[model samples]
Target: MADEDNPDSGGTVIGYERELADITGAIDRYGTGAPSHIAIVAEPMAGRTTLVAEIRRIYGDRVNYLPLEFVIMDSTVLDCSTYEGDIILIDNCQFLSTRKIGGFDVLDMFLRTQITSKKLFITTWNIHSWQYLCSVMNLDAYFPTIVTLNRMDMPVLKQVILSRYKPGEIRFLDEGVAERSMFFSVIHSTMRLPFTSAEISVPWIKLNFTLMLRKLPRKKRVQISLEDVILEKINRIAYGNPGVALMLWDESLKDNAISLSAITETPFSISLDTNESFILSVILSMESLHAKDLAAIAGSEMDIDRVIYRLVQQRLVRDNAGYYSIEPFALGPVTDYLRKTRRLW
Candidate 1:
């Protein structure tokens, strides 16, 4: 059976079986003459584009693909109305609006078009942006079929990362650390007092395969391989985001060989002011943004250059030419800080 006929029949699902099913099921509903617009929502680098690509691959020319790379204008949206396809596919729908006063104008326009148009619209969104929009504009009511992606489990993430490779293509090497039980790690953090700043050193314990394997019976523990241990570490650090796990997988793969110690964490303490935190929040939602547009959303009070410099120096955000984004490995930590400080919606 075809993917449109059955979502599970699709290739390289990236563990999005449920989301793909929701989307294709909506498409099936459209075949019955009742159009159900779809929204694919996920965190940045969490496979939003991958999902859109899978849809296009399955549906072929029946889908019209329009991916927004930056903040869009009213004219761009005017052009969007002209695409005549059974399924209109869009990626990075977060770019349809900005976070400023007049920023949501284009999004509002697009939503209106979606409400009145007869064509089935299948759109992708950054999860943070969707949440913010939901809070402010009640965005959920617009799309009856909402496909939201979340973190995968260790087994699912392993399948996703290995799907790209042929069987036994990559070798997992044992480094003899499997027998060791406990390890000590130290990280530096800062606390800002009313008058002075101070650094604090903290020691923490990390659970490798030792703690987990110990819970199992002796026979089961003996059955686990270095491969299982390596993948588990990757999933733990990635926090179940397949994209980040794959990135870590690629980084750990050296000359087609991987070891337990090779997959490590990217450690950096994140401390930001109100303005800096807000900018980071914007980058998290938009995924990537140019300095000019970031300035527009950040407004006139902020010195965009300095903020960018600080974020870059701290390794929280990366500046590619001018398109700034949260560092792939830093996504989890950055998000936690933003949410804890209430900078993100």
Candidate 2:
């Protein structure tokens, strides 16, 4: 679907109408007598900052925004007893704690202050960190209104990308090659014999070839535009994160043109042992960490060098100076794998 109505508009919040409305409604209710506290949870580069910006744009003076950067500031900033605004917006709440023991003291203090204060608090959290906190401390119980962002669907994803460019400004190239392919596979299994003198299990040896073919296109002209198809692929690779999708678009665009083949997808079948997965989870939660810090988090039982070497060999991570981080394109797949295995929490 083409977003012709708002073709010239860029940087507008897309696919978050319901979430915006819920947040605004909470603030409005707070103004009248209801006590409201909200928690906006999303993955990194999943548009938490964008949604907060939109809130600031709408509320203007009524909102007092406090962006927390824990790398520089510590728990002392959580002493919000002096804040005067009726509605307080805190971004990056994940910075309140670390992986070390007793690191959640800041979060505990903040929760205590929030419960006593009359002001409505709206906070944003990194999804992975939030999951960990939820599992460890039952953090979600404190926020009466929690809004978790869902991944964008294809139509909304198309609208978001198209809104960034003018009509026909970016060329969508098609190589004319097949959009998909087919393959065949063979399988072997064990079976039980039923008609024998006595029922027995035996190895089933048979020539079994299964053919899987890609769905062919309809005889009629395609309904979706080439740009839409490219955007769809980009969104798929990005796992529906708008910011990641935009980054992919920039990386794939060449000479003001983008092709279906230009957008690459990270291999989803990457295998990682438990130690590597734990180390990756730590790195992802912290963005980048030194080897010593990683080792500290991974504990002495783990051989950090071997795990790091394996991760580096797989191209899932990169080392900068003495720090390591997930590769840019690999973030989506790595995060998905960690989440699937329940290691991110």
Candidate 3:
């Protein structure tokens, strides 16, 4: 809110003040006597890039930045020997490895080089990839300070969105409608075990009070702002990922006005076979990949074309040229599915 008018303030970087401070503090400590490396980890489109940009803004010319995009850059560029800065910033470190080849070799070399060099390395990683690498290589132990972004609260999310627009630039519709409340009944039953008696709780569907309330006349209910409802839904679908939230906001907007009914979430009932699911997870982790890369990751046995066709038909994936990626709105649902299936760590 303080920087609402400041053109340079890249919105509120909400929910990350402490993280920014810790990063800067580490840099300062390293400058004086202490030496440390930092890792900023978050899910895809969770503002890792924005956070890194803020870091560059804060440090200015004092820090050297190396942003990595594995899809476009060669793997050999990861060599840290050529970089001559005391403070190094690397983005998308997840690209160090791919599904076909275990890229721990490059990661090992990078880590070895950084550990020996007197430099403060600040890096960002995809949460899933970070977890995988940590499990495989104990990667967390290498970075003395690691800051993870958590799911943001409603108010912070609101501020983050509001910061992107000038006051009154966009209309927030408020339809005077009270949201329906859900209620459930728990049934307690007594059961006899083989050797002992026990009481257990069972959940049962109760009357749909919310539905009944919705049937009432509009005049009798307390009106909730449509803008609040829309934002709440966007935040929910985004799972507190700022980038995802912004994308949802842009997609939902119609002629500069947003309505509660206009905001919709991708259905989570996607059906994928084992191989399809694995390929989807790979795409989500990598953000995007070519068919060849997907095949390499899926292994020789997988019919990559059939899987891609199925996913595309379901609207779960979109193909650009030969590259494949999860549809924008489908990101949340895909992530939820992966988390449920333990594909995402």
Candidate 4:
């Protein structure tokens, strides 16, 4: 079998070529007398984790990869006094600290170690946590190289998903929903400026909202195929998140086949008290946390069990055994809510 046909090899490397160049360039510079630490900033499904994997694939054992799957306690964090490769890659570095008083102690110690040690560090962070830390701890000053994984456009998103399969492998079954103009609708896009983290609103594409205002009966239907429509819907809902798009594709596909109507986007409606909102925001920043860590971040006053119960009841968070995190479909709504409530910086 061809390598491209294998799903394990599929990645958004094409979309991330520029970012890969920037990071690899930083690593190359590390060999010089002037070495620089780097940080990869992105949301959960934004492909930063994939980029980290690519880095590990390239450098092999030369780079030490430490992926933080859950919240890290103070006793477990490395002081950087010990041994490892000269290059260190830490994924999900947001777990380095929590959002409470004295919570940043571990992060402070880690930063101090990084400052004194000569090891080249490449770390990844959840964007919300990174922003909060930037404001509160001045984290921007620690890393000279910061790579924010920008959202991809429709074409790039399409390419990344399609590249996962061999040509003509999966059949696209059109369910005849071509009349709706979902792709070129007048929706405003949130465009983030590179490096500066500034954002602006731009119309994605201009066209009829739903084509529901047609006065006369159309003589012929639109020529758009079911494949295009499905891709467009996936792109719109995923909002340029490659990982999320892939997940939706897998969820929609049945027996190696897909239809335009098979893809459904779940809209989220959330209302929570201050403590619940705060705890949810912490989970978002840290990705996932156990009950103990959540309670630690929630502090003494907030009833951790009650807050978790409310969040779970609302379907805003999912409990995998003991680890708690925002539901995949609720990611957008939860982020918006936290941002609006000033819970996230």
Specify the highest-TM-score model's number.
4
Where is model 2 more than 4 Å wrong at Cα? 1-12, 32-34, 71-73, 176-224, 288-295, 303-313, 319-324
lDDT of 3 by residue, 64-180 (tens): 888775543344676666666668898888877775566456777788777887778898888778888888788888888887775565557788888667888888776433233
Q: What TM-score fits each model?
A: 0.84, 0.78, 0.80, 0.86
Instruction: Write candidate 1's Cα lDDT for 104-137 as tens digits.
Output: 8898888888888888998899999998998999
Using TM-score, rank the candidates from best to worst: 4, 1, 3, 2
Q: Which portions of model 3 miss their true places by more than 4 Å?
A: 1-12, 32-34, 71-75, 175-226
Error of 3 at 271 (Å): 1.4
Native-to-model Cα distance after best TM-score fit, residue 201 in candidate 1, in Å: 33
Error of 1 at 287 (Å): 0.5
Candidate 1, clashing residue pairs? none
Off by over 4 Å in 4: 1-12, 81-84, 176-222
lDDT tens digits, residue span 1-345, model 4: 112233256443767787889899999889766459999998877887678877877777788878888666674567554646788888899988887778888898888877777899999999989999999989988998888786666666777877768899999996746435563643445677798745444656655423333423565434544575677778677766667777888899998898877888787789898999988998888888889988887788889999999999999999999999888777777887998999986
Global lDDT of each candidate: 0.77, 0.72, 0.72, 0.78
Looking at candidate 4, the ten consecutive residues that score lowest on lDDT are 1-10
Q: Is candidate 2 or candidate 4 better by TM-score?
A: 4
Clashes found in each candidate (C-alpha, N, C closer than 3 A): 0, 0, 0, 0
TM-score of 2: 0.78
